[model samples]
Target: MSAATDRTATLYRMVMPQHTCPFGLKAKALLEREGYTVDDHWLKTREETDAFKAENGVRTTPQTFIAGERVGGYDDLRRHFGKPVADPKAVTYKPVIAIFAMAALMALAASWAAFGTLAPVRAGEWFIAIAMCLLAVQKLRDVESFSNMFLGYDLLAQRWVPYAYVYPFAEAAAGVLMISGALMWVSIPLAFVIGTIGAVSVFKAVYVDKRELKCACVGGDSNVPLGFVSLTENLMMVAMAIWMLRYVF
Candidate 1:
């Protein structure tokens, strides 16, 4: 190894080793698990902690400096988990509120369909239309990173694939048809099937055995909720899709 490479072997860390500090312990344990000896300073003195934070931009302990780069706090440590671990299903995953609303609207629109419950929001499937629009907003602004510490366009060096093109476009197109109110019969079902597949696939991919892949889901937020997060999320989508499809077809 060249001198530059050899120097890389030493992982730098600074922490006020204490029981009360979550960030401090998390940062330390994570590094130790990764096989790097922590070079930490117990900053009991106010002057020392202040100087460290001022110099390093870390008011939080244990503050981590890896290879000369400052990674802040414990949540920031999740950045190391990598993007490859991203659940593919999350690509289409949406929150429960959005999913339920879409289904409710689609049901309300249809008189002939068995589900009159979805009609309130089903004006030509406007719910899907607006969702696409909002997603477009999120995609443009890159809200995914709003929740992520490390993964961002910066990580990919600016290369990115937006869901608008990858999946939302399809969702939007299908939604438009349903909301147009012309095909309450056709568009509703289309939405359901498409949404279901998207939801179910991602739910499985996230919870099931999958490889490490960076999450490209939302601009960058990788702080995921624990426990079969995939299942409930995907299930809702699948159910919404089925419900929509039921009326449209």
Candidate 2:
């Protein structure tokens, strides 16, 4: 094939009434982005799709062909163009980092709006409170999953399974009350109790026992490794509890 002919490619993808293949659309877009002229073909019926798959010796749709050479699916096309493929099992701190960064910004914004300036102490308090609320939201999304994961390293949760279910709610309640500067009696004690337990659990599990595990702080489905980040979360809670204690007396 000539160099110009090589720039032209053929794509066969599923586009049925009930379901259009998402990867097929992605593959076409990628080919276009890479400056390829796609001769797009659609397998409109199940029989046609099955026939095509059998003919091509393949099991999936959204197949690409360049200069009579089959290039597989969307991921294959990406690799052909030297792009990185996503791995679902990859460990990452992105979720926790995003939560913490957003919390910091929100805290500053709230401080400015309420006090007419970015009050450092107030922002700091709000930062921790907002972080807790956000983290709780993650766990609350899948309470059962969070509880199951929490039972892995949390001493209290391991002993009393019910605490696993209650932990997120307690964290959220403490955060909300701390933010409002109301009911320190409830929030302070709750934060302190949970925080102390969490810190000890994390330290013993990671530092002393040295067992590798995934953190449930972000959520049960998280890839964040159980370590300093989880420890920091508990420490922050404990610190916030102590700071808020001044108001109780």
Candidate 3:
């Protein structure tokens, strides 16, 4: 056998009838990927698992050992190998990505129903409209929270607090109106103004000030960072407004 394949690692993981630990399986996979031969030890029962933890004085299972030294849990194993382990509290773009993905699917469905085909241009239009409506819904769910977060960066909202409160309603109204391709006079201008302001706010807060902040786009409870996703949301609205304006004129 090759020296890489001969490198040995040890792991202890729970594999009970009621609960099977996934981390243990992952750790074994990771060890194999790194060319280590894993001596996997399974704790088959709850009592056995508890007893193992107690014996080792460790609270969690899927404990790893390398060269007769403890390497800790799954995250610890990752850290040992210099792999990136994500912090649970860290802000990410996952929520926004999910929202956009769902919005795109919805747009595709709508386009298919209306045109009997997956019209790319029409789908794009519906995507922006649907995305705006969904984002507005998230804001409307907790206006107070949205406003408080919004004030952190929004130029107008910081200067005039009432704009923060009105923002969600305007977004919702514009989105709804745009979806039906009606009330261009009101929706177009509202989308344009808010989109411009939002893009500027995100840019200033994230780039200019170098401030790490949560995006208000997915609501106050979101961990979505205030950056590309937020800017994309605003840019979508701006593009939609311009596209709709051209149709009106």
For lDDT, the strongest prediction is 2
Model 2 lDDT, residue 232, Cα:
98
Which segments of candidate 2 are over 4 A away from where they belong?
Answer: none
Q: For residues 98-207, write the lDDT of model 1, one tens digit per residue.
A: 54465445445553374544445443344445444443344335444533421221212224444324444444455556445456555455556545654444544445
Compose the digit string of candidate 3's lDDT tens values, residues 96-144: 8888899999999999999999999889888998889988899999999
Query: Using TM-score as the measure, what is the rank order of every candidate, best first?
Result: 2, 3, 1
| Minimal lDDT window, size 10, model 3 | 1-10
What lDDT does model 1 reach? 0.48
**Clashing residue pairs found in predicted model 3:** none
Candidate 2 per-residue lDDT, tens place, 81-124, comes to 99999898998899999999999999999999999999999999
lDDT leaderboard ranking: 2, 3, 1
Q: List, in order, the clash count of every candidate structure.
A: 43, 0, 0
| Candidate 2 accuracy as TM-score | 0.92
